[model samples]
Target chain A: MEGPKIYGELFGLPITQTLVNTWIIMAMILVVCAILTKNMQKRPGKAQVIAETIVTVMDGLVGQTMGKDKMKFAPWMLALIMFLAFANTSGIYGLRSPTADLNCTVGLALMTFFMTQFYGLKSKGLGGFLKGFLEPMPFLLPINIIGEFANPVSLSFRLFGNMLGGGIIMALLYSALAGLYFFPVLIPVPFHFYFDIFSGLLQSFIFTMLSMVFISGAMD
Target chain B: MEGLDFIKACSAIGAGIAMIAGVGPGIGQGFAAGKGAEAVGRQPEAQSDIVRTMLLGAAVAETTGIYGLIVALILLFANPFY
Candidate 1:
């Protein structure tokens, strides 16, 4: 509600709870990946089966959203989705979701935006990409530029807003119910399910899907 | 000079006003749900696909409402002026 608390400073940079949570998420992901891939077997074990299923699902998602030709983007998409899924659901673990912080969401959105522009330029030459802005009429260039700039802003705010809203509601609910001993224990479960689990996963999926659409749209 | 009470009052009003953005998403999602129901009624076999698409589009449509909630929360808990 009051934004992520700054715990301390490291060197010159301010360290916030969000940063710590992000690092934790990253470490967890790394450890899981390491454990899953530590041993290779011709006849797959349960861990290998789980890992393969995840890979196949991600591959299918990328292929469906960005086209089969863009399967190269599957790894990045998988990483983004996995990070977002964990970040958005970190509230269940009593950690402030990094996505709730404007800085985090903006950074993620900027990555998508830059990727969109970079791939656009790569697929279409600079001249062609520039020419895209002048389509139908050259006078529409300013409008097109504004629309292009709005992408990252809306993308960031959409995610930040949803995550922060959930955090605020959960905080307020806990405070309001604290007076009732049993209510505090029992009432927040459904709210937690909807906000932290359902909305978190759905938002992560939406963000990944939108990123795919934007990048692929640029390339195509 | 305005006292702390005035600031609190204004923050409360601001939070209330910010929540007005929810109206747009409420109507939009309801419209989507109705259309989805119509489609499913017409082709019951494709209900799963229709529901999936409807949910995705509704989630996108929810952006504005979430934006409103953010503004309201900021006003209530993170009032910059305070």
Candidate 2:
């Protein structure tokens, strides 16, 4: 498929604008994380407040969904949600979202797949893990294995497709706006509101929640 | 031997093929929605928060679907090969 073209080559590697923007975003996340973590406060500072709110919300979410036993996974889930939320919302700027790249999405999905497997193996020993597949029907072992194999493929593609769609629409919308700025404000604003802001955060949450669901299901 | 016509038809077909990616989010979001409904039904008091979380998750699920649409649209209107 003819998608965004590489602008140039750096050391034989085709570096697209998306790749550069991802580095920029990565740098920003690292800086922010460092700053936020370094500044610890008991009374409460504004930055700490913001960070605490995010952690509190996500922690509550993990506790509610996965039960108290899985609270350890909360921090990982929080990091995933924040990283993805930022990655998806990066489209608001002129930069290409990293989520648009299959590499990024697939990598994230692979991590989730591994985490699910890891947690499953931890909660249930190797024999118990194998027994999970044989549930409901011992005859369906092969099919169940195939279904487990397909999880990451499906999960990765789901996020990739959605982010790519929003980015493309936003691109087209901006192009449309360039030619016709006088287009009804309501029409464009709501579209941006829903597609970029809402969809970005929503997708990240879904990714985390579904990852949790799969892991919990496996362990159970 | 109308090669150009074949390419155009192929792209049109390709556009449709791209949209097929929409199935991923459709099923994913539907699951989120059903879970949200179930959560709300069980605990009506937490309806607002449940709905909020559900929508957030559904929004993430919606992204890939949007990507497929973008590909389809590009194929239709901004075909690079053209």
Candidate 3:
């Protein structure tokens, strides 16, 4: 409904709810990882099983999306997906979802953009990477360059727009129901289910999937 | 006062107009879903893979609608004209 609240200023930079929410989400993720991975077991306990399942699923996803040889990217992709999932779902807890902020989404997208370019050059050498823009004809080089830059713009906007849109709709719905005669308890549940749960989860998955596609595309 | 009110009125209308972009994704996703169902019917064994691909494609197709939403929200909440 409105921009993230500015809490205070530090070193001439204003601290906003988005930044605070991001820090909290990051710390929560670290704590969860520590708890899940605390004990080592040959057979397995519940937490160990959960940790192994997450690792195996992410590794399989990276292999399926990128390639079997690119299994090295599994950790990075897993972190991206995990962070995104938390950021997007934070809305359900009354905290502003960090992905709803353009700055946060842009930062995430920039990481993907740089990784794509870095790995592209790393895998194909400078000459081949540069020559990629000239395919079909030299005249199409500018178009190709624009397309490369557009990836990050679209990626950031896609996540930001979806999360913000859902947040706005939820906010409007709650305010509308609050003005009604009866208690608006159960009325907003379906909306919460669709907007916060369904769309949030789907957008997070789509973001990570698109990132994987872009990085893999550059490499191959 | 009159000019500011006029701009706000126009932006409210423009926000409604921007949402016309939703029609494209609505139709595109419906077609995708229909085709996906047909594919599943033809090859029930690959239903999981087919549905997964369909959902991903539908999400991508929904981007234009999301773009339109961003434009409408900008006009409503972060209006440059304001």
Candidate 4:
């Protein structure tokens, strides 16, 4: 349908609705996390319980997917999943999802790409990392190199396309029912359920899980 | 203007054609789901793990379909033919 609204120019750059929504989401998450984690407690209260559950679940996920030794990545992976879940579901609140923007998804995917490479190098050393490219056969080096570059492109497009597709479908559905009484209100709930809630959460999980797999795969 | 109209018509057809890529993932996912179901039937205790692994693999398989969708969307909303 329509592109994200350009609110105004900041310096030479245009400030868009996507950026505003992203900032709002960031602040909301920050506030919620701060409130949940307030004060030290040996016996956890309700808020602390929520915080502890989130941390424990994330740690468990990282441990299961990436192994116990890679528990160091749990916090980063938790932050990623939380941001993605919120961004993908922002459509529910009538805010355009920041993840629908190509720039946002690409930036995230690039972070994964860099982490994968950096960790690979760190664990394997420069020689071993290069040797990885030559594995199975030296002739497959170019293919391996291309495969490495393709990872970020595929990861970014996978996320961007899914969110964008869901947004487009929801937009089309809303407009088609706009003139009908009660139809617009009733018909879109299931669509919203699938696209905004179910698909949003699933995609976020997939993205986080893939990142963990990639990063850990590189390290080991 | 006449040539522009022809280009637009061709782009519309191209968008539809791009979506043909969905067929592969549809078939692949169905096959994967069947196997996943079989695995669950064999070991009910590991159903959660089986489903999780199935979903992850299915998502990866769905990437080609997503690429097709992206091309179609670009052609429809952000057409360069104009």
Tens-place lDDT per residue, model 4, A131-150, is: 99998899999999999999
Candidate 1 C-alpha lDDT tens digits along A1-220: 6768899999999999999999999998999999998787999998998999999999998998899999999999999999999999998998899999999999999999999999999999999999989987999989999988988888899999989888888988988887774645667899999999999999998899999999998896
Which candidate do you rate higher for lDDT, 1 or 4? 4
Put the candidates in DockQ order, highest first: 1, 4, 3, 2
The whole-model lDDT of each prediction reads 0.91, 0.81, 0.92, 0.92
Candidate 2: which stretches are off by over 4 Å? Answer: A1-14, A34-38, A181-187, B13-44, B53-82
Superposed on all Cα atoms, the candidates' RMSDs to the truth, in angstroms, are: 1.7, 4.3, 1.2, 1.3
TM-score of chain B of each: 0.94, 0.93, 0.96, 0.97
**TM-score, per-candidate, Cα-based:** 0.94, 0.79, 0.97, 0.96
All models, DockQ values? 0.86, 0.45, 0.85, 0.86
Candidate 3 lDDT tens digits, B1-82: 6999999999999999999999999999999999999999999999999998998899888888999999999998899986
Please say which candidate is ahead in TM-score: 1 or 3.
3
What would you estimate as the lDDT of candidate 3?
0.92
Superposed Cα deviation of residue A115, candidate 2 (Å):
1.6
Sorted on TM-score, highest at the top, how do the candidates line up? Answer: 3, 4, 1, 2
- How accurately is candidate 1 docked according to DockQ? 0.86
